[model samples]
Target: MVRWHVWIKEHEFLGKKGTSQDGFRDLLRASPTPKAVTGRNLSSEDLSKSSLQGRYEISRYAPVCLWEEDFSEVKQAFDDLRNRGIRDFRRHFEKHPEEILSFAGKVKINDVNEYTLELYQAKTKEDLLKGLEIVFSKQSYEVFKEELIALADGKTRFMSEAVNRTLNGEQIHILLSLAVPPGYKESLSRVIVCITDISAKQRKARELERIGEKYRKIFQNAIDAMFVADTETGIIMEANESAGKLLGMSTIQMVGMHFTEFHPKEEREAYRSIFEKHASRGRSLSDNLLVCQRNGRKIPVLFSSSIISLDGRNYIVGMFRRVLSPDHAQRHARAGKSLVTERKVSSHAKERLSGREREVLTLIAGGMSNRQMAEILCISEKTVETHRTRVMNKLNLHKTADLVRYAIASGFVS
Candidate 1:
């Protein structure tokens, strides 16, 4: 017999004695290979459990108030009203608000987060539930009812900016989101409602609206011509009524036109340089600038420009005043070194006279009658007479000869 060593280690057998092949086979048969261990099934179960736990925690500790409401009673009440031939549920609810208010008792508040208590200034959840009736004023209840009906009918998933009151009687604005959980019909659905405080946001929006309205009124009624243009492209974005009148164009026609459109072709490059320089430095004043009107009339204007920022974009705002009289035009022209020699009046006496008054004085010095002056000026005789009187009073001249002498002395006439 041959000796063989057999060693047993844990559950496996190693032979030390001489063994037959059958005995070795029997040992191999008795010890089958251990099955492969896998945690896939266990992992799937843990994942589902953790997912539900996460949802629960989120609902319980959310920043805003979250609640699950049972609307079974409200549905039943509406069904009863429908059986009584009330086709329009809204109309019925409006007429019988007391009945609708009674239906609130049937609705159950299933859960509420900590935010609910804090928002309502309640010490406990029960305190909040008890004071829920005070939260819905008459107007708020009306709004709430409409939202509830829409939610039950699956018409909308969310409603926002609903006004509510707190336990302390402070008004609060809320945005509400509604959802129906799985396996629930509309009538008996468990609705999850999320409430967010939007009181501050609503107040800010209304304030901005009021400010915009005030600015609109001021812009529309301003006396001076106003133009708003894109700073980079020089394209006109907005023009006031006065601007259109000054340019002899409609407001609609003025918009979308380039700023250079109002300048003479020869002076457009100069004006562009001035605009760019002023825009870079914040403001600029160009006196005696000639603006070409839509009717081909050249209007002497004083252009005041400033850079304004709106909605994070830079814009150029220009205010312009028309030169009404020749005297005024000459004065502005002299400032720009473009004075007209023929229209120049050197008399100190004519300095006190306005453009219209100077025109009347020059004609008076030429021996023109009031009616002739009116005809030449395309004005009424009465208006011409008024201008003559003002000129005489300003010069303290009693007679036409004295006015004519003064006009000649002032170089207003040949």
Candidate 2:
């Protein structure tokens, strides 16, 4: 047996004692050949062995699960399979899925660290090695097949995510990093594998995906026209269904178009200035804006915008509310002047009005015209006009000011 021991100070067990009080300092300044052992020197093999032992010590105490595997047998098995005219391992494995487990059994587990045992809930190395199949999940076969292909192609390293299980049958998400050590690629005699637990990270990711899906559904089904744009580029990143309908375009068509493109070309520069001001100030509302539809018809809208940040980039979320008309301000002031009338809608007129007609009347009292009501109710302008006409005929109120007074006296809008 050959053994080596390094001591900082001479011990009594070696039957040796240092003369100087500072043994370390003296040793550093000593001759290459000490007088006590002048002819004896450490061999090259001894130094190499000691270096390997140091590395083994490091692996034993590492915090992560470390594995040392021998793949020479598996390599030979692959060679035999390839010689049998099996060029596509993936297709062959797919046809004979059970062969994957058979090949996995061929891989020899040379050694594993303490952390490996802990991670698999094994009390000892032997316990883990005895039931190796219990730790692998069904998904592991896919990852293993990829590793095999990488090995067949002479790749030096491979990395992937896989699902594993513990002895107690608890599933674990893990990231596996596998590599052939330098000079070992030809024989693949020594392969190193590292496994990191990523269960918590994957769980959080899944949770975020669910939350994002929920909000995405809400945004797509919103009642108001909404847009998300890049402030720097002025490009529309997102538009909801209501926005597409109001602008006479599909949601797909609205995306990637400039925000100013939806406005009148002659007034684009003015709208761009307002958009920049809204983006800079973080939040704004302007009712004097107009949006041009695909058919070249212009519609007045109340536009409100707020700045938002997502994934380190700033964006503007703008919402558009359709207004009564281009001359709505004058009509609104006129309606306000006649709201103090004592004339109330009769019960006969109230009963004659259908639900939709009454709804239109209420919206009219709220200062919405046919186009604006059509946008809000998601109906056509003709349908909204029909409802408005029915309400007027039922109430015997033809003027806009008379409808406003009647709606107020009837307690439809307060």
True-vs-predicted CA distance for residue 7, candidate 1, Å: 75
lDDT tens digits, residue span 30-144, model 1: 2322223243344555654444454445445667776656678777776776788877767776777666557656777766778878887888878877787677666655556
Best by lDDT: 2
The residue pairs that clash in candidate 2, if any, are: none
Relative to the true structure, candidate 1 reaches a TM of 0.56
Best prediction by TM-score: 2
Candidate 2 per-residue lDDT, tens place, 305-371, comes to 5677898888887766565532554455455665333444566776677656766776687677687
Those runs of model 2 whose alpha carbons end farther than 4 Å from true positions after fitting are 1-54, 284-288, 324-414
The C-alpha RMSD in Å for every predicted model, in order, reads 22.9, 14.7
